[model samples]
Target chain A: MADVNRGSRPLSPHLQVYRLQIPMTTSILARITGNGLIVGSLVFVWWLVAAAAGPDYYAFVNGIVTSWLGLLVLAGSLWALWYHSLAGLRHLLWDSGHGLELATAERLGLAVVIGSVAATVVTLALLAWA
Target chain B: MEHLTDRKRAEGRGSARSGTLHHIAMMISAGALVILVPLFLIVVVPVIGAAHAEVAAHFARPFPALVAALTIVVAMHHFRGGVEMMIQDYWQGMTRKLAILAMILLSYGTAAAGLYAIARLAL
Candidate 1:
């Protein structure tokens, strides 16, 4: 009924066979965080719809979005936004015939992680101050 | 090593017409987002935790409204092109069709709703 034995075939190199590197991991994470960003965009939609609906509706929606859970989603979203944007920049560099070197690629990958974290912190800190 | 003529190798590599197109579209959108996102963050961050009237007033201003609406719409376009490549890489046949359609609709729906809200706020 099912080809349960397909796993035994000599397939391409699988994950278990070797070590993973930063660039490799970041590349995969880019797609994941992209999806996360999409979900986060819905928060904005909720805000807009509530605002149009009226002040009471806006407050209700805004209250939920500002709660601890909402903050977490916002934080995740901020990081996703930063990370994806930077990674996309890296891809653009590649498209333009730069950052093709292995060392530079790995460095770019690390920058995505660090840059996103920094941007999120700065944005949140500014929000706190404002 | 396998023997190959230049023409044979070129033909074997397969059609890349759509691949280049996708790459260019994605890059253009990425270029726009690189500017729009930061501008949007700058605009929105100042108004965080603000009162409803204040928030509405902030968005009603042309600069924030325009930056945000463009960012949302362009970002969706970029997302669609990029995510479709990922989906195609792992999916095929019916699954690919369904997944691509679902993603496109989500992106398009988001873009439309977002623009409508911005239009209401701005106008």
Candidate 2:
């Protein structure tokens, strides 16, 4: 049987204690954005190795990239880049002692997500036309 | 009061150095991205059209190669610092902390080897 009545223990000063603030929110968002960057880097590494191998390998990767699924991954990478870039800017501002207020932080966090999507769309459109 | 003053000074120095290193690493990472993204678009994208020789030649350019090298180095440094912080926060025992440190060292070492290979090829 499960111990349903187990008492809660004292916890460390984690995210739960205070109201959401910009610095904490930005830090959380940056971590999530880092996952995207990591995945994108792995894809890039695969592309690099494929390019270095030979035409056959290159063609294989090229085919995948030109496909719908590949395009989706490429789009994701672009979104990751923009998201991480905006998050980076947020960190830069925090380091400079600005944007510490709750309203500003929340506004910037929303902007980062929306702006990343916008940037990704623009990049994909340009790539498609070019 | 005297002891408290000494402790405050030590904390200040420690934080100041940490902040400076982080700022420098972030700036380098940002600058490298500026160079790398355009290089990817300009030189590398077209290489997808050309033969392997042409691609090799393009990478062999000193500027592009240098940019690649810098990007790799700065990226590894940034990753190492972030991993170290994560370890400090989550790892409890000394054994776990040491293990985390060892992992970080190995990661940086491997990255260094890979960057060296890329640089040598480019040069």
Candidate 3:
């Protein structure tokens, strides 16, 4: 018979009990940003579909996405994209048997955080220039 | 079951029959995105708030349309994989199956829509 009392088993202390660390925080951010990009992806799809539908529809979506609220989402997504990309590179490095030490992992985590913000700012600057 | 040794039974059953195929696919797609994403942003970002005609004309060009299409397809595929893992982590039983199914549909559906739209604009 299956263990019916499994639900009552003592559970280990979990996420809330531990103080946060850079690698842990960065790993969590990676999952968050990866999933969050879906929103931005859907919005961009809507923009394309609207454009395909008609000029008027395109104008409507274009207007909304260009609006301040939409811009905010875009900016967030831009940052998320950069962060996720850098996080992914870190994973790839780990996969190759590199950067597994705790100190190095923490440093990579910091780099992911700071680098993403810097990349977002530069991209925004370039967009403005263009 | 006792006839087989542990190593023999587990040899081909590491997390599924496909083994590391999913991981390999994700790595390949991630590498692809590293290229496709920057090219895509360069193509699409500048025309953010442009008028309809200008925006349409810009994307209607072959290079921009192609970049957008590639990014849409690759990104959605990657999203599908990532979301599947998330659902598996947090959901269970029928809910997990259904959610994964729904997301698979959504991911491919969006990819198809984007491709169709890009095709229309380009052609």
* Candidate that beats the other on DockQ, 2 or 3, i.e. the better one: 3
Error of 1 at B89 (Å): 1.8
- Clashing residue pairs in candidate 1 (N, C-alpha, C atoms within 3 angstroms): none
DockQ for candidate 1: 0.28
Question: B18 in model 1: Cα distance from truth in Å?
Answer: 1.0
- When 2 and 3 are scored with TM-score, the better candidate is 3
Is 2 or 3 the stronger prediction by lDDT?
3
lDDT of each residue in B1-123, candidate 1, tens digit only: 145555555674576578888878887888898889899888865664567898788888999888878988998888888779889888988999999999999998988998888787677
lDDT by residue for model 3 (A14-93), tens: 99899999999999999999989988998888888888888888888988998999999999999999999999999989
lDDT of 3 by residue, B23-119 (tens): 8898999999999988988888677677777877988798898889999999999999988989988998899999999999999999999999888
lDDT of 2 at A67: 71
Per-candidate DockQ vs. reference: 0.28, 0.11, 0.43
Model 3 segments beyond 4 Å from truth? A1-4, B1-14
Most DockQ-accurate candidate:
3
Q: Clashing residue pairs, candidate 2? A: none
Q: What is the lDDT of residue B15 in candidate 3?
A: 64
